[model samples]
Target: MTHRTQLNQAEEHLRRSRENLPVAAQLLYAVADLLVDAQPAEPVTNRVAGLAFTYAGLAVLAQYPQAVQDAALDRALAVVPEARPSETGGEWALRLRAAAGSVR
Candidate 1:
């Protein structure tokens, strides 16, 4: 099953404000929770900033740990196109579900 959690706080934040970090932070938190629910074996953390471009989808930013840097970059750089959903609530969750599936 594809599970997508809508960060309404983030969406609300985006709508009322142009703050990126707060929104991105919520995005990151949602992603982390999604990953755990999706696959418990794999652990992902946002130790550094992350980047998700329209074409690139989602990519890890910031410095990576010594052992995982290259691999993380490789995985992050390979993401397909992605964007913030205009649809509120469940729509955003589905988008995240799709993105997670794409990652797999």
Candidate 2:
């Protein structure tokens, strides 16, 4: 391949990688938040919708999840325009320890 073509390919790969990162971080923390700490079945539909919204938002912003691909980016973007990463290794750590204790 020409140098120009190689550069384009590398740029595309970097674009996709940057787009995907915050999405994954948001999702891991969201699942950890709802499933790990709270009882999700209490409100039923609303709680489920909240989870779905979270996933949709992340996929729209990050483009990582396969399910979001099926629904298309527009659908995901309809609920939330963007997603951001969660806070880590701070006061939140204390809350988790209080709830479930340490793995190590």
Candidate 3:
């Protein structure tokens, strides 16, 4: 499936999982929509930042404590996209995993 399709599916999953939490459900859907509709011509840094924010948003949907979610946010933001231009998506994902783990 296309990446956009995958994102839409993910959004649906998040919505289904958090349907009871109205505010979180809304936030999750909004984030997914933004990711799926992101401009291809946008700068790499912006895309990287979007991924970072999505990671933090997912942490919240996963029912992490506020402290852990904040830590994830901080760690994700600390990744300077411009400085890591050579890193692949998998590498950044690993970093995000480490960031979340570090707080636990």
Candidate 4:
């Protein structure tokens, strides 16, 4: 599948995970692992990176272990800071910043 397709699937899993579904975290993690393992050929768009970061931040907010949250945020930052809101990022960027703030 294309990177976009994978990203979309990941986004869906993340949403379900946010709703406190027991199995959703596993699905989200699987998608995250797949994305990490299958590094994209071309750089992903800022929006896509921003979404990933937001998801990671959400996981942190949901009280996943500190190590897992840190790893997710670290990976997200490595790809794109996504630390603040921007024209390109909108709410996702804001959500990321909020998540980061809560972690501290």
Best by lDDT: 3
- Estimate TM-scores for all models: 0.27, 0.23, 0.34, 0.28
lDDT for each residue of candidate 3 in 1-104, tens digit (9 for 90 to 100): 99999989997886676545433333433333443345323433556557745763764535667775565445434532332565554444444334433332
lDDT of each: 0.38, 0.41, 0.48, 0.46
- How many clashes show up in model 4? 0
- Candidate 4: which stretches are off by over 4 Å? 1-14, 17-61, 81-104
Q: Model 3: which ten-residue window has the lowest total lDDT? A: 95-104
Candidate 1 C-alpha lDDT tens digits along 1-104: 22333566666765454223322333333553444344434322232113222212233333335445444345433542243333333333345445544442
lDDT of 3 at 1: 100
lDDT of each residue in 1-104, candidate 2, tens digit only:
99999989996775565444434333333333443344432322444436654653564435455764444434323333222234332333233323222111
Question: Clash totals for all models, in order?
Answer: 0, 0, 0, 0
Off by over 4 Å in 1: 1-64, 67-70
Model 3 stretches astray by more than 4 angstroms: 1-44, 51-83
Best by TM-score: 3
Angstrom error at residue 13, model 1 = 31
Q: After superposition, how far is residue 65 of candidate 3 from its true place, in Å?
A: 9.9
Kindly indicate the candidate among 2 and 3 with the higher TM-score: 3
